[model samples]
Target: MTTISDGVTVVDHPLVRHKLTLMREKDRSTKSFRQLLNEIGMLLCYEVTRDLPMEMTEIETPLTKSMQPIIAGKKMVFAPILRAGVGFLDGMLELVPAARVAHIGLYRDPNTLQAVEYYFKAPSDIAERMVVVMDPMLATANSAVAAIDRLKERGAKDLRFVCLLAAPEGIERFRGAHPDVRIWTAAIDEKLNEHGYIVPGLGDAGDRMFGTR
Candidate 1:
């Protein structure tokens, strides 16, 4: 892992980079792209949860009794921002099946490039749990910032943001809006394009994942 700043980490694992490169190929099929994303999601999940608190638990073995470390405290919530973010859920769930899910639906306006929320659902006790927000690309950060704003209004305190790729502009915007929340990403690209997409990023993650235009 590489620390870009006090709260930003880049997961530079070889497998993650390899899979991400495959997903970036122009001719990659929908099925292959989705599969690679899921795999990378699992890998990223491992990196992001590395510092979770642990407690010793007593267990009986055939030969003797022993204590083992297990995750402690209330289960975390995985908050995915709409269509593209959902692509990261299944792989993360494979590693953290007990985690609760929160869905935040927001779409970017073509003209203004602002986030508009359409749906929000989360646990009533969200205030008591850690929340990890997932989005594949942090291009303009409009959607990410809006999603976190809603979650904070709902009483979420401890929160983190994860993405497959990030643009420098998006990072700056997101940090400026929500500096308290840490970020984990596989790679931080150069910058955002004229249309607010990350340059060198796999285009339109939602459309690519869902096979939509």
Candidate 2:
């Protein structure tokens, strides 16, 4: 497990690693890519919510009474940074069907390489629940940073960031920018390319996911 710093976790499970390898391949079909993304998303979700508060509640079995542990609190909010982020939704939803979803749309300007927001919609009570921001890539950290900023503006307090891959520079920038938010990712690659793309990354996640390119 590679540790970048506090508030960052790299999932070291074999299953996560194996699936990530397939996703990183250039020849992966769109259908297969989407399926692998969902499967991996579910795996990452498990680790992300590992420490959620749980309380024991009284329960009755067919032959006896017992206490079972249940998650304590309002349903979690899944905030996917639209486009590429939507690819992770199905898998996360499968694990947390009751989770509320919020959409944040951001695009990077080629010249400035900065995140520009086009849309933002979230639950009014999002601040009352834990929010997990999902995106498949964290390359320049522009989009991730902006998305979290918007979430905070909308009253979201407890938040976590999850992604499939990240560049070392991106992770460093993000961690420095948002030290309070925990980051979870499958792998942290070498660095960002000249155009702000993660080296050894699976190319444009949005394009691969939707077959746009």
Candidate 3:
């Protein structure tokens, strides 16, 4: 695997670990697992949004009025990598209720090991908004690359990728394919198993999250 380019951020916050611990267990129930994923997603959101633009604004208090500051423009749209990504949307929406939503679906080609897009939908103003792709796992760069490439085609100039877990192999692949994207992952795992699953990973995050197993 290649090395991490300086721009890819890997967050290791306390709350992230706490919630991740809850989700990692085989005993965790579907509801609990899903909730934990949302909690982790919120933390990921905080880290990924650290560089958002802000501007000053006028404010008033019961005792006094003041000119405070707030986010300049919520020119943001959250795009989840389809079904599994949907698991994170609600929790993040709680934080940025006004943000628009988009969805993209990419599946690995069993034979080719490349990402193939099956579906895509985004807000009409996607170009003007900063886009974030949310997924729980990045085992290989294939899916992420394909999804991001589609986003770029639709006019997303500024983009960031947020995920709960990532493998070194996957990150390296992603970095090579996309030098401009800034990746924010909660933890970087050792490597992908022979089947492309992250080692010591929580296991089929989408299935585990929704209790498909």
Candidate 4:
């Protein structure tokens, strides 16, 4: 229950914790893993959109017409960081069906451990909307930082970062790089291993989720 000064929100819901435990287990099947990720993604989506602007508007109910509060103002854009980020898409879309999607492809260089961008595509009106960048693992923060940089270069003004697992080092570096960006994560683990993987993390999310490794 540590509150970070860096606008990092650690969602402490019991459902998130329970599913994370299942995901962390090495024996979990690929099918179960993906299913759990979607469930957890839905929960995280709920928490992250809490501050969405709402305006009162007239609406019709089953038996009566009345003014109801509805989401208003800037639209939402979900920028998922390639393959791994895809796992969270269905759940997030279930919450905000009208939100646009942006895809950013980045891969870590094994030798230098740097993030290299492969592809980037986003909505034309990115600057006018709220962008939420999704990546399941925030281990090195290099990809997250680079991805946000690309988005800003393309005129994305409002941005938030969401991930399933994050490390203290990665979170610190990410916050320092973009203090304006809010971070929402399910769990912040101990630290990264020598291989740059979060300790006690769910492992390479893309590999496990896609059975690539």
Which structure among the candidates has the greatest lDDT? 1
For candidate 1, lDDT tens digit of each residue in 1-213? Answer: 889898899999999999999999988999998888899999999988999999999999899999999999998999999999998999999999999999999999999999999999999999999999999999999999999999999999999999999999999999999999999999999888899999899899999998896
In candidate 4, what are the lDDT values of residues 1-213, reduced to their tens digit?
344655999987999999999999998999999999999899999988998889999988999999999999867999999889989999999999999999999999988889999999999999999999999999999999999999999999999999999999999899899999999999999999999999989889999999988
Candidate number with the higher lDDT (1 or 3) = 1
Q: Of 2 and 3, which scores higher on lDDT?
A: 2
For residue 201, give model 1's deviation from the true position in Å. Answer: 0.9
CA shift of 79, model 3, Å:
0.4
- Prediction 2 global C-alpha lDDT: 0.92
lDDT of 3 by residue, 22-65 (tens): 88888889899999898888877877877788898878899888
For every model shown, what is its TM-score relative to the native structure?
0.98, 0.97, 0.93, 0.97
CA lDDT of 169 in candidate 3?
87
106, model 3: CA deviation in Å?
1.7
Q: What C-alpha lDDT do the candidate models reach, one value each?
A: 0.94, 0.92, 0.84, 0.93
Q: Pick the TM-score winner.
A: 1
What are the candidates' C-alpha RMSDs? 0.7, 1.0, 2.6, 1.2
Residue-level lDDT of model 2, residues 45-107, one tens digit each, is: 999998999999999999899999999989899999989999889999999999999999999
lDDT ranking, best first: 1, 4, 2, 3
Query: Which candidate would rank higher by TM-score, 1 or 4?
Result: 1
lDDT of 3 at 173: 87
